[model samples]
Target chain A: MLNSMLEFVPRIPIAEGTEWVTEWLKEKFSVLFDPIKEHLGNFMEFMSEDVLMLIPPIIFIIAVALIAFFISGKKLGLAAFSIVGLWLIYNQGYWDHLMNTVTLVIIASLLSVIIGVPFGILMAKSKIAEAIITPILDFMQTMPAFVYLIPAVAFFGIGMVPGVFASLIFATPPTVRFTNLGIRQVSKELVEASDAFGSTGAQKLFKVQLPMAKATIMAGINQTVMLSLSMVVIASMIGAPGLGREVLSSLQRSNVGTGFVAGVGIVILAIIIDRFTQNMNKKKA
Target chain B: MPVIEAKNLSKVFGKNPKHALKLLDKGLSKEAILKEAGNTVGVNRASFSVEAGEIFVIMGLSGSGKSTLVRLINRLIEPTEGSILIDGEDLARMDKKSLRRVRREKMSMVFQKFALFPLRTILENAEFGLEVQNAPKEERRKKAEKALEMVGLAGYIHQKPGQLSGGMQQRVGLARALANDPEVLLMDEAFSALDPLIRKEMQDELIDLQSSMRKTIIFITHDLDEALRLGDRIALMKDGSIVQIGTPEEILVNPANDYVERFVEDVDRSKVLTAQHIMKRPETVNIEKHGPRVALERMREEGLSSMYVVDSKRNLKGYITADDASAARKNEIGNLEEILKNDIPRVDKETSMHEIFNIIHDSPIPVAVIEDGKLLGIIVRGSVIAALAGDAEVNIENA
Candidate 1:
């Protein structure tokens, strides 16, 4: 009797409904989506090809190593690691792919911070906003990275722009969550002191909250950059170019040696980026 | 007019504050209202006015709402009901722009935890208030420098707050408020976070600053001794309500209720009770009008061992013991000044009992209370002990 009752319930058409909604959004918002795709795609390509590719590999590697040296307080470890790592990637003939991945990750992380901070501030300032945004963030974070590619392709067609869109959906939550947590974790007495001195909302935010929350926000941004880097291999499924494409093609041909080299290149990039950003945070302190 | 006036000011925390306020007006107790309405009363129908250039202290134990009461004055915590007035201007009714202007121009606050921005240098922390007001950069920098110098932190201007000790950090906090040059200051347990020695040093500095600056101040503390030491007048709070508002002496001598009485019970009375509160009228002989024979006779009649000698205008000359006066009379010394002993201790009327204890311990005769060379009263050992024992009424007749 219970089985019959369970079978009597009709299945919900969530998949069909989502498809219809996506198609409707594509048809209706093409004007808005088209310009963003064209402009952003051109900017990303210009950054990776025109700007980054213009630098000689040796010069770029030395510059990054020097920056690592200074930012890590004259430490030899990070600078040595950067030089060795970049040299290995260059020797492996994945330097251009490395640059493409760098451009994709940097743009995605910047965009996440720009959009996430204000939303985080809103969540911190208002209970209603926090309540409304929290569940949406959870949904975005838990949803599989592959699930976003469909919408990303629908919105931006393909390439680095769609890659960024998918990565942004995957990576933006940490920044928003951390910014909110950082602002909320500021001592109550400090907030009261700010208010007591007649600080306007903007004044309190910029002067007191943001400066105090810096390390935490930087940590969040570091996580975001890592998340964006992780999205590259997945993003290549939609024709986004980079080491991710190298890895994808190697996977298809079952070329374990090439795929392993490409994977090592990504690991080297992640460590370099992570160490540089972490060292920057420590330098400020 | 008062510099800051709060009338029927109240703060209720939680949802349905309107209902809580209605319950407050119906005379329901704080606990009852909390139980029935799920609202906590922060400050309950508080009404007080702080005079210009005086330190008006609000004192209570933790959670008694003294902090809340002070916050209401500056509208840091918006009142659930009632109004606040600054120089006869209704602050509660002011728009946001005007309120911000008033906050910038009229008052600033200091906090207990030394809320200096750790990332900013000491000079930049001091510049915060003026920076918020959008003052010119050069002007704000100059004022911040001057304010930092005022707090004796000129040497540490370029150092961040994290590099300084607790007391020095608090000095930066103080400089931050002073840079604005506001007319009034609200200090919420501003020295509570410091160790006892540093707290005392800060208190003395605040008193010194008050003497020169004479800015109206609203100070909050959970310490009874601090309240007595710094307050020109103190309001004692209990359970979100002010139970008494009076001078420290009044609060100590005649507490408004059992709660206030218990609150002040452990205060060191010697620090608060002064010579004026414990002094007795001294029987004196006028040297120009009376001889040693008359002085000896007057001493005998009053049953005193010694008598203070004064001139026709009542300036303290010295004192004559009964033996000295009698011996002088036998030796034909007509002037009382000829035999008078000049070794008696003298203290001002405002001298604390703590100081009198040190002086009176070495003196054979009573310590004479003098003002401008004229004797007002004398503090005897018995009187000092009596005052410390809470019998301040013993010398009220002389006052």
Candidate 2:
């Protein structure tokens, strides 16, 4: 085997080269990561002072009531009202934290969309592109949250930037996978019909395939949002502050009341955001 | 005389044949081509032509490449070998942009599954072709509305494809095709997926649409009955190759072989074929005031095989078979309507001997094609057998 190696130049082992590569990637990633986090922190901290603001949550609660009235009836409406009442009882003040979380989710989701859609298009169009990207998505999805933090800390150091980056990474697969899946799932008969009508490749993709994929892609968006929310708790370990940080702080100090209260607030936030996004998806469908 | 013609247009699926012009851009090595060869010969050098505004149908079982043939005409599937010329323009020579323009402006298609864009409303779906061609928004919308009205889906403008029944969805598909105002309309089993009743409704709608539009149509189907009912000319296919191409009368009365005969064996003769193929020339008949039933009895009395059903003016009326005349006699035969199996298989004076063979075989009984309710002749199994066996001369008469 060693003599056969002479026929071709010997390649270095991955372990020998990966550490330096990792450090280099880490340095390159942080160059722009820290500043964004600092700016996010400043905005979030300022917003925290006005966290007691209640108008939006109250409105949201009412909207939930209206929607629930139609979906599951008055009983569901009452259930929605009680959920709102519980958020109020927690004394965490719903508005500002919810807004900050919303900002994070929106930013993360938008970034995922930007990266996911083009990547999906490329993957769907070519087998080689799919071979390279699909497995990476599988890894991203399967890897533990703690493992994600290693790259996050090494690359963006610590804070909101790292949180957002982690969130984007975690939430990306659905957007990419679902978009590709929906496009692929469209009937071949329809594609042929469109082609027969003299639709060019671009026209076929955008008008026929993309339009048909709407509901499916929306499902992907919903999945991305849900995944991004899961990153909030893990992101707090990187000093990313908000409900996640509060929950962690209370748990560390053995303050069950504080931990439970903050945890409940986070759950309420998730339900509200999930419900709203789900409704948006329904309307689009 | 053909508006569209394919000279030995063979579409083999394998990567390479000795003389096959490679479909894709880069040429592969013979070894690699051999290794990666795809299976199935989709279109086996199919050669047929359609006259301008003629409803030419291709009928086959699933995977017999009937769908492949229609798609190939528009070059939706690039042929592996041979040439396809549409109005003397070689489709193979057209570039991407030119091909697109041809498709958008010259050709349109109706699909087996309707293929309506569910996201868009009915009106928008119809306007898809115009949109692809960059038709202005308002103009496309107006044209789409008009096309929808033509298909009788006028009130369904705002409805999504999912909101409509299968028949309505197919109508929308037709409307979309018409929206392009295309020169040639390609339909691939457009009504195959609908219910029997709905299929009939759509077929009638299509016949009406085609009559008024006069677009050259290339319709594909597995249903022999549909081909007979709808085609001006039917191209019977098997194993990716055309077995025969002729008028309905020629196909029924003089099928090319046993394969086609089996396919048309159960067909309804009165509904499909005409009364012209089987009509016998009157040999010294002076009685002109007789009904078709009386004419049949006269032929029987004179020991003739068949007799012409002519009017007082000595023009041919529809012919009646001896059996048909006798069948009508079970009840008291009084009038011409009572005695005559008035709806016999009829052919044009111009119908080829080939079509007469298929339709007769397709029908439940031997028949002839009629022109203006006048029989030219009668077709029995023997005439078709002689034609296919290549023995007897085809005594085809023009009306």
User: Best candidate per lDDT, number?
Assistant: 1
Local accuracy of candidate 1 as per-residue lDDT tens digits, B1-399: 898889999999999899999998899999999999999999999999999999999998899998888888888888888899999998888888888898898999999888778888899889988988899999999999999888899998999888999999999989999999999999999999999889878888999989999999999999776776789999999989999999766676567898887776555576567788878788999989999889988999999999999998899999999998889989998898678788879999888776777788778888999999999988887665546544347555544
In candidate 1, the second chain superimposes onto the true chain B with a TM-score of: 0.73
- lDDT string for model 1 (A34-64, tens) is 9999999999999999999999999999999
Candidate 1 CAPRI level: medium
Give native contacts recovered, as a fraction, per prediction. 0.74, 0.88
Model 1 chain B lDDT-worst window of ten: B383-392
Off by over 4 Å in 1: B269-399
lDDT of each: 0.89, 0.73
Residue A89: error of model 1 in Å? 1.1
Model 1 root mean square deviation, Cα atoms? 7.7
* DockQ score for model 1: 0.80
TM-score of chain A of 1: 0.98
Taking all chains together, each candidate's TM-score versus the true structure is 0.84, 0.75
Please report, as a residue range, the 10-residue window in candidate 1 chain A with the lowest summed lDDT.
A276-285
